[model samples]
Target: MILYGGNVVKKAALWYILIICLRVSAKNGVTQDQVSSRTNTLFDDVDDTQKQLDNEVRERLAQPKTVWVIHIPTRFPVLQLEDLSVTEPTFINTALVRSRREYQLGNPELEDPIISNNTTPCENVEEESSSEEGNVCDSDRTESEKPSEPEKCEEQEEKPGDDWTFDTQHKWHENFPDCAGQSQSPVDLPIAGLIKTRGARKLLFVNYNEIPNNLTLIYNGRNVILTGNWPRDRTPAVYGGAAHSRRYLFHSLVVYWPSEHTIATLHYPMETQALHVSAEYGSFEEAVANSPKDPLAFLGVVNIYKFDSETQAGLRTIINSAQKCKKWSVSMKPMPLSVFSPPFKEYVCYQGSLPIPPCTESVLWMIRRRSLTVNRESSLAFHSMLLGDDPPQKVFIRVAQALNDRHIYFFR
Candidate 1:
C-alpha cells in the first residue's frame, strides 16, 4: 500500500500516468470529506478542459457539410469505443499516426512521406502544414483541436511537375522547343476548301474488331492514355490515307475534353487521338525519335463526339472504367475498337504534330468528316471522379495552332 497527501493530487495529478490494475483509493485514515475537498479543484480543471473539447466538436459538426470531404490519414470526428481496462486520466491520445498494436508502431527509415503523417489511406486531404498550433495530436496540452479541412480538388492537382504539364503548355517552348514548331498540331481543320482525293484504298484497320486480352488505362496527371496489347503480325494498323507506302500500327490513344482538332470554330464535347506509329519502327519511342521530319512515322486518327440522348455500351464501359482509374494505370477489361475507331466513309487528312508537348510535328491526321454522338454520363462520371460531385473544371485546352498554309486533304 502507498499513501500520498492531498498536496500531490493538487500539483500534478493530470500529469502523472497511472498503470492499469493499480488500485487508487482514499487513504486508510483519511475521511471522505477530506478526500473530496482535496480533489475538488483538480476535478474542476478536468471538467473545464473536457467541456471545451466537447463544445468544439459539436460546433464543427453543426457546420454545413460538403458533398465529399477528403481528409489525410482518416476522416474527421474519429469515433473510438471506451476501453475499460485502462485507468482514468484527464486525456487520451486518439490522433496517433501509427497505432502501436495495429501497425507495429514504429516507422521504418526513410518512410514514404505521404504515409508518414498517419498510415491512413488519404483521400481528398488538403494537406496544410502539420505544424499548425493546437492540432489534435497535442492531446496532452490541456487544449483540444481538429485536423485541417481539405482544400479544393483543383489545388491538390500537381502543377508544373518534373515532366511537361498541360497547365503550362504556353510556356512549353522553354523546355520542349518542338511545341513551338511551324507545323504544330491541333489546328483548325477548315473543311470547306480542303483538297480532294478519290479512290484511296488501304484505309484498312486490321484486328480493330478483335478485343485485346491485355489492356491498360493510365491517368497521367493531364490526360488519360489507353493502351492495347497488339500482337506483332496481327496488330491493328491503318494504311493508305496519308501514308504513301509505310504501314502504321497501333501506338496509343489520348483522351481530351473539348476536341483538340476543332471543325472550324466549333469545339465538340470530347475527342480521342488514336496515335499510330510506322510498323518499320521497332518501338513507339523509335517512331517518336524519328518524327521531327518523317511524316510516315506517326498517324493520328481523331474521333470527335458529343452527348446524345442514348448511351452506347462501349462508351459506357469506358466511362465506368475511367472513374476507377484514379491517378495511376489500371488493368482494364478488353473494350472493342468501335469505341475509338468508328466507321468513316470519308475522312479529312492533314499533316501536324502530336497534340501535347514534345509536340513532334510528324503525324498524318485522319479526322472523320462527321462528328459522332455518345452519352453525357461520361462527362459527369469524370467530373465526380476528378472533383467528387463538384462541377467539372473549365476547359484547359490548347487553342488551335496556326495551320501556317498547310494543306488539308479529303480522302474518299
Candidate 2:
C-alpha cells in the first residue's frame, strides 16, 4: 500500500521499523537468502511509493492551484516553494532564515501560507481554495516587520591599534595604492647592489649648529612630532647631493620605533625621519600638493638602543616630555636642532617617496648607514605612548617597498 500526504519524518520512522523487523526475523532462525529477499522486497515497496508521491506532487504543481507551498527539512535553510504568484516576488528570493522551528503549509481560509516565524504549520489546510478569496503567498508580517540582511561580522572595520596602526593602516597597496608606485620609501638596502662612490657633495646645514633650548613636542596620534616656527631667513636648509643647487628647507622631525619587519630587515631599534621640502615651495603643504616631481627629501636615521653606554640626551628629553603629555598632546620646550641632527655625514642616497599617505614620488632619500644609540629604558617608553586615543602602538614602521629599477648610491 502507498502512503499519501504524510510527513517525511513519518516515512523515515516506518523505514526504520521495517529494518528492525527484518533483523529480528533473521535472529529467529530465518535463512540468509530469506532475509536478503525480504530486504529487497521492502526496498522495492519504498521505491514504488516514492515514485507515486513524486507523480502526485508533479500533478498537483501543474494544476491551477490557488496556493502552493513546500517545506523540506535540509542542512541549510532553503525556501522550496516555486512559481509563487505574489505582487513582490523579489523578496521571495532564497532568504536564508536561520531558525530552529519547522515550517508547513497553512490553512487557505484564514490566510495564505506566507513565510513566517511561527513554530507550527497550518493545522487546518483545505484541499482547495479560490484565488479571489485572497489566497496569495507572501510574507505574513508587514514590510517593516521583516528582518534586515545580516551584517558581515568577519569584515569589521579596522579599529585603530587593533588590525590597523599609524604605519600599517596606510598600507602600501591595500589602503594606499600610491605606495606601490615606482618611487616608494624605506626600501631594503642589499649590500650587493650598493654603488660605493666618493662623496657626491656635502649637504650644507645652515644654523643647524645652534641648539634650541626649548622646542615644541606633540604626539600627533601617529608619531611624536617636534613642531617649531621656522625663521624666514635663518631656517636650517640642506643643498647639494642631487639637490641640483636648489635648497630644501627643514619641515619637522618624527620619531618612531622599528616594527618587527623593519628590525628584521634594517636591524634598527628606532628611526627618525627628518622631512624637508624644496625652498621653491613656500611651505611643506605647498610641496606636498605640488606635482609628484617636486623636490622633497627625507633624511632617515636609524638608532640602536644601548644599555651599556650613556643614553642619548636628545632622546631622553623627548621621552621625558612624552611621559607628561597624553595622546595627541603637544609640549613646547627647548629642543635644539642638534638633538635631531644626523650623527653620520655618510649616507645612501636613493630616489624614493614618503613612507606615509599620499606617497608622493620624486623624493631624495638620504638613509644614514651609521646608527645612533639611545637608552634602552627610554626606547621602551615609546610602547607606553598611545597614538591619539588609540591603543598603544609599540612600533611604527612601514613594510619595505619594491626596489624596482632604483639604484642605491653610497656617499661617505
Candidate 3:
C-alpha cells in the first residue's frame, strides 16, 4: 500500500515478486494436524529428560534407618548365610528365594527348621524345604517353643582298677565289692605272729634323701610301677612308719613278681611295695576319699629272697626298669630315695587291703622286718622279663589274698 518512490524501480521489483508468492503459499501450506503436532512435541522432550535422570539415580541409592547390629562366633549344626538373596525376576518370571541348605533358616515360605537335639523343634514356616520336603509341621508348636537340650559329652572317669587283673584277681570280688570286703589285701604276713606294738612308730623318712632325676616305669595294667618325680618341696615322705599317723606322701614302688606279702609261711620270691599318700590329702583319690575310717594309706613291704648272690644294685635297677614294661610306660633311671628306702631296722605293722583293685581297706601295712637276699641271676632275670608280654595262664601265687581278721604289728 505504499509503493510510491515510483514506479520506482518498478515498484521495487514488483514488491519482490509479491514477497515470494506469499512464502510459497506458506510453505506448501503444511497440515496433517501440523505434522502430528510436531511429532508429539519431540517425544514430550524426551519424556522430560528421562524424568530427570530417574531423580538423580534414586537420590544416590537412598538408605537411612539407623540401627543394625551384629556379632558372630557361632558353632554347631547351624547355617545362617545371612540375608541370603535372589529376588529373581527372570524377565518377570517372578522367583524370590533365600536359602541355606541344611540346618536351615531361610523362611521363604518355610518348612525346614526342625532344630533338633534328640527331637522336638517343629517350625514349618511356609514351604521352602527346596519346595516342601514332605512338609510336616502343623502340630501347633506350643510346648513353649521347645529348645533346651545339649548336654551329652562328659563321661570318662572310672578306673576302679579298670576291671581288675593281678591274674583273675580272685574274680576281684566280681567287679570290686572291695574285693569281697572283710578287709582284703595281700594279707598273710604273720612273721611269727607279730603284734608287739607300742602303737608303733619310728618310720618317718622324708625326702628319703631326695634322689629323683627321672623314675617313671609304670605298668598299672597291674603291678610293676616305680614313679617319683619330686618337687612341691622335694616330695618323698613316709611319716613315722609303723602305723603311719598320717603324713604319707612318698607314693610309688609296687612290683610283686612271685611274692606279695608272705613272710612267716614264707613265699618271698620278690615283693617291693612302698606306696603312701595322704599328706593332708591331694590325691590317692583325695586321700582315700577323705580318709574313710582313717589310715589314709601306707604300705612299705620289701620281701625279696632269691640268693645265689649278686644282682642287687637296687635289684638291678628295678630289674632293668622292668625290662621297659612290655607295653604300658617306661622312662626310669634315677635311683637313691635311699636306694628305695631300705633301712627299716625292723617294722611289720598291718591292717590290710589294696594289694590291687578296689581292694581298698585303707591299708597301713609296713613289713621290712628283714628278708631281702636277691641274686639267682636276679630271680632268673626277674622271672624272664614278663616273657615277652605274658598273661595267659601260669600265674604264680596270684598275689596271695585270704588272711581275714588281720592283725600283725611287730615294730620292735
C-alpha root-mean-square deviation, each candidate: 34.3, 36.3, 33.2
lDDT of every model, 2 decimals: 0.58, 0.51, 0.52
Model 1 clash pairs are none
lDDT score for residue 34 of model 3: 47
Which candidate should be chosen as best, given TM-score against the real structure? 1
Provide TM-scores for the models. 0.58, 0.53, 0.23
Could you tell which candidate, 2 or 3, scores higher by TM-score?
A: 2
| lDDT ranking, high to low | 1, 3, 2
RMSD of 3: 33.2
lDDT of 1 by residue, 1-412 (tens): 1346666775565455442213345352243345455444566768879999999999999999779887641101122322222223243233432232111101122222212223322111112212222111122224222212212112123446347756678899888888899988898765245555554454666666566766776665567667888568767777754565568888787777767876534566677788888888998779878875565578888876555443333334455566443365656756446445554445667778877777888888888654444447666665455443334553446879999978766654
Worst 10 residues of 3 by lDDT: 92-101
Give the C-alpha lDDT of model 2. 0.51
Error of 1 at 322 (Å): 1.5
Q: Cα deviation of 73 in candidate 2 (Å)?
A: 74
Off by over 4 Å in 1: 1-162, 324-326, 386-396
Q: What TM-score should be assigned to candidate 1?
A: 0.58
